[model samples]
Target: MKTVLVTGANGFIGRNLVATLSRREDVEVMRIDSKNSLEELAEYALKADFIYHLAGVNRPENTEEFITGNLGYTQYLINILSSNQKKTPILLSSSIQAEQDNPYGSSKRAAEEAVFAYGHNVGVNTFVYRLPNVFGKWSKPNYNSVIATWCHNISREIPIQVNNPDAEVTLVYIDDVIETFIGSMDDPDASYISDYHDISRSFKVKLKDIEACLVSFKSSRHTLVISDLKNDFERFLYSTYLSYLPENDFGYDLEMKHDNRGWLAEFIKTEHSGQVFISRTKPGITRGNHWHHTKVEKFLVIEGEAVVKFRQIEGEETLEYPVNGLSLRVIDIPPGYTHSITNIGTTDVITLFWANELFNPEKPDTYYLEV
Candidate 1:
């Protein structure tokens, strides 16, 4: 088994990386955080086949702490490895800020230099990732990532400030970063881009666009409408937004329409794929004596026995499909055919339905007819 050491095990990226590594049967992980003593790090360094140097400070109380946490600690770790004559391959998680002239950037740059020098002098393999704004689950809000802050505040109904709506930020999802980090263990040189290793995928979005997406996510509960997820950036951003929802608020009530026959509630609505809804009908009750001009639907009886009847708009022949919860079958309702479902069982019948388009009041496209 390969022995891997990870610093900052409690941090966002470290937590995700450690979880992934722990699931592998062929790897053993040694985790070190601020709570652990320096002696533990020294001990782990001796047995480590690889090290992920993710421990660093970006929001310190003082400017001097940046050096102590980012640069000084990195140098100390290298010194310990050098003393033992160990040549363990190391991967450092540097930030894009390293190119700037701020104190945090200077400290990160110094740490990168230290790792490169160790690799050069000791002939050990090294990988440095100058990551952009990383966002996903477990990331701290208002600390390092603006995405995290927006997700947290928007999910909780707290007001968020947008100083510059046109300002753009580049982002890399946590999963992508983790995948790139794991890939480095097998072949570090393959991911080299110019001077450092980087995640293959990144998204550049304007502040206004991000705010709009988050607002839409919040409004989805009321509208039952899901935004287009085929776009990679929106998909990733939506996942990140959900990760910040309050624990108790994970579920929301759906609007149900009640009538003498039964109750029906829409579940999900999408722009391209259409909508899905569930319904319940009392025994001896029949629903849907109508035909659509262009819309189509699918019905699956999930809880009781039912018979779905369909008839062509101009034909006298009627087709019947008997379905039950135990059998688990789906019946497609074609356009230009009048259809109806009758619950024959003693108990209420539960069915799931999918439609090709959202129900429109102005242009229902539905004509009442007997089936």
Candidate 2:
């Protein structure tokens, strides 16, 4: 079994990494945080087979604390391992800011240098990741990532500011970072670079575009319209946005249309994939005595029994498909065919329907006819 040591275990990336490592039966994890003593850190350093040094300060009150938190702690760990003649592989989570000349950047750069020097002098393997803005579930809102802050505030109906809408920021999803880190453990040599390694998958987006996507997410509940998730950046951003929703606000009421036959409600609507809706029909009730010119649909009876009847617009022959909740089946309603569904059972019949196109009032391709 591999014994892995992780510092800053309570922070965002640290928490996610630790959780992933803990799920493996063959790997043992040793976590050290602010609450742990220096002696504990030294002990873990001595016994660790691999170390993930993720502890660093970016928002310290004083400039001096940056060195103490980022460089000092890293140097201390290296010293402990060096004095004991241990050559454990270490992975340091550095930032893109390390390229700048700011206090935080300087401190992070120093820490990276220290780790590289230790690796060369002591013959230890080192992996340093100069990561971009990382955003995901456990990230702290308003602390570091603007995406996290916007997700939190927008989900709660609070206004967010976009100081420079044209300003662009590069981002890497937390999951990708974790996957890369775990991959390093499995193959340390492959993760090495001359100066520092980088997460392979990253996105560069404008502030205005991000705000627009986030705003659309908040409005989706009422419109029943889902954003295009095929785009990798939007998909990851949407997932991050949902992770900040208030616990009690996870569910929103859907608009249901009531009639003598039963009630129907739209579930999801998409531009490319069309729409999906659910409906219930009372016993002896029939729905959809109509035929479409170009639109197609699929009917699924989830509860009770029903008979779906279809007749070609140009023919006299009628086709029938009997379906029930016990034997779930999908009956495709083809174009140019009049179709109707009758709830033959005693109880109400529940069915799900999917269409190829969104219903348009101006040019409703539907024509009423008897099946």
Candidate 3:
């Protein structure tokens, strides 16, 4: 089991790290933030496998806020971790602009330098990941991201103004960034430099186009940079960037066919064996060479052609059957029955879905065999 600590426990990224990491069974975590109001640092930070230092201001109104809230908090974390005397990995989440010309960027750079210096002598595996703009579902409004504000405008039908549409910037999904940071923990090859470019005005996106992606808006000017946005809405622009793919798996049942033309019809999933369970299979692919102790399943071929082979542990086995018929197909496997399917057609293969019960990770009822 792993015990990790996340500093800056109240902020957007901090909350996200907590929620996401909590899903894993083997991980135990500690969160530090202003809400808890803990005065003792070393006691709060001891005996953790990793320390993700994300406690700091996103975009401070003045240099003083940056110093006291951002750098100061990080420096305090260094003292606590050093005093703890444990060889835990410390991941410093810094912004790309930290060392750049921006005020927030400069303060971040200072903290990054301190982290490196601390790691050199403190016996901690210190590493830094300077992330670009991170956007996704559950993103807080207070975070510094223009993309979230845009999304808010989309949801609220608020009028949007534009300034610099041609500035170039990079944007990545918040989930992806989290995966990157999580993957970096305890990396024996921990290095010093990690750079990220997020969706800021650096990338040229027309003002109307940004609004068009989510909603319709009236704007005379097209696009603008972080500096051009109104100060009254200073924090609004820092919302996470939006992407085409929704965070969850769901959409309309429309064919919504596009350029793929003849291929995607095969990849769609439309079959079910239980009340509700769905998965996709491709042409020339085979699945489920195993048997369930209590799982009885049926597959309905919705597209392409498929052939299934079934063998009962204490009974006779059955030969393959043609599954190319677009009509519903049913093949129920009794307990201790083994089966698998293969696509026999040239096009993509798809099946309508269903399952008797939800799959349980802790108590899987299935067993696999190579043959």
Candidate 4:
């Protein structure tokens, strides 16, 4: 079996990579972190078929620690591997800050040079990824990534500070980074050295846009409105935001309106696409004997038995469709067609309803009629 060694195995990227590698049966993984000694890392280097040099410190208390942790430790790893005459391919996770003139940037740049020189001397493969801001579930908050800090704070209803809302950031999701790292291992030529590799799909978004989207997600609970999920950046940001919510806060109760017949609750509503609501009808009770001018709807019975009756506004013939929990069917209510659903079973019937437009209190498009 191929042996893989990962440095900084407990850090954000390291933990995620190790978790992924552990699930594969073809390779054995050696995780190295602050808990492990240099001797232990050296021992693993001798046996490792591949090395992922991901250990680095971006948020150290002392400025000198950046050099010791990022540059010194990387040089130490290269020395150990070179001493043992091991020419295994090493993948290093560098950052976009390496191009800047700060201390942390200089250390990262020095580490990249050291890894490149080692590959040239030993004729081994080396890959340096100058990754952008990465955000996901397991990232540490208030340390390195602003995205993590914002998501964590907003999830708990804490206030966030934004210095420049107009500033744009290029972000790469952690899953995509991991996928690219894994794909490099499957390459046939492992001895080819590279200066830097860019993640293929990075999103450039303004700070204000991100905050607005996240705020909308928070307001969705009360407003029952959903963001435009069709946008890729919005979709990814929404997923990441939800990942930061406290476990107990996962489920929220929708406001259910009660009537003599039963109850109805709006699940989600969108600006352009419309809304979804659910209702319960008691046995022998009927609901919705109405026709719409421009609003179209769909009805789905998920429990008990329901008979959906529809009649054309201009015709006398009425069509009925029987639906039940066992064999659920969606009945579409076309515009200009009067429709009604009756609970024909012994138990209360549960029906899910979808409409083409959000319900406007001022201008309701519904017209009462008998079907």
* Per-prediction CA RMSD (Å): 1.5, 1.2, 16.2, 1.3
For all predicted structures, in order, the TM-scores are 0.97, 0.98, 0.55, 0.97
**Local error of candidate 2 at 344, Å?**
0.5
Candidate 1, which ten residues in sequence have the lowest lDDT sum?
186-195
Instruction: Residues 1-371, candidate 1: write the lDDT tens digits.
Output: 99999999999999999999999998999999999988998999889999999999988889999999999999989999999899888899999999999999999999999998898888878899999999999999988789999999999999999999999999999999999899889773543322588798999999999999999999999998888787988998999999999999999999899999999999999888889999999999999999999999999999999999999999999999999999999999999999999999999999999999999999999999999
Instruction: Report the lDDT of model 2 for residue 144.
Output: 87
- How much is 367 displaced in model 1, in angstroms? 1.2
Q: What is the lDDT of candidate 2?
A: 0.94
- Kindly indicate the candidate among 2 and 3 with the higher TM-score: 2
lDDT of 2 by residue, 138-190 (tens): 89998989999999999999999898999999999999999999988898355
Residue range 1-371, candidate 3, lDDT tens digits: 98888887667677777888999998887888777554644556776778888887866676788877777888877777676665556788888777588778778888887887787776556777777665665666435666666665544446555677655455555656567667777456765433332322223344454554444211211221112222312222223323322345223242223332222221222113224333446667777788888867677777788887877766675657678657667766566767787777887777654456555679878899522
lDDT of 4 by residue, 1-371 (tens): 88999999999898888988899999899989999999998999888999999999888999999999999999999998888888888999999999999999999999999999998999888999999999887888888888888888888899999999999999998888888888777678655675688776899999998898888898898899989687777888888899888888998999999999999999999998999999999999999999999999999999999899999988899999999989989999999999999999999999999999999989999999999
The runs of at least 3 residues in candidate 3 whose Cα sits more than 4 Å from the true structure, single-residue gaps closed, are 38-41, 59-62, 186-208, 216-371
Ranking by lDDT: 2, 1, 4, 3
In order of TM-score, best first, we have 2, 1, 4, 3
lDDT of 3 at 35: 71
Clashes of each: 0, 0, 36, 0
What is the lDDT, from 0 to 100, of the residue 297 in candidate 4? 94
Clashing residue pairs in candidate 2, if any? none
**Could you tell which candidate, 2 or 4, scores higher by lDDT?**
2
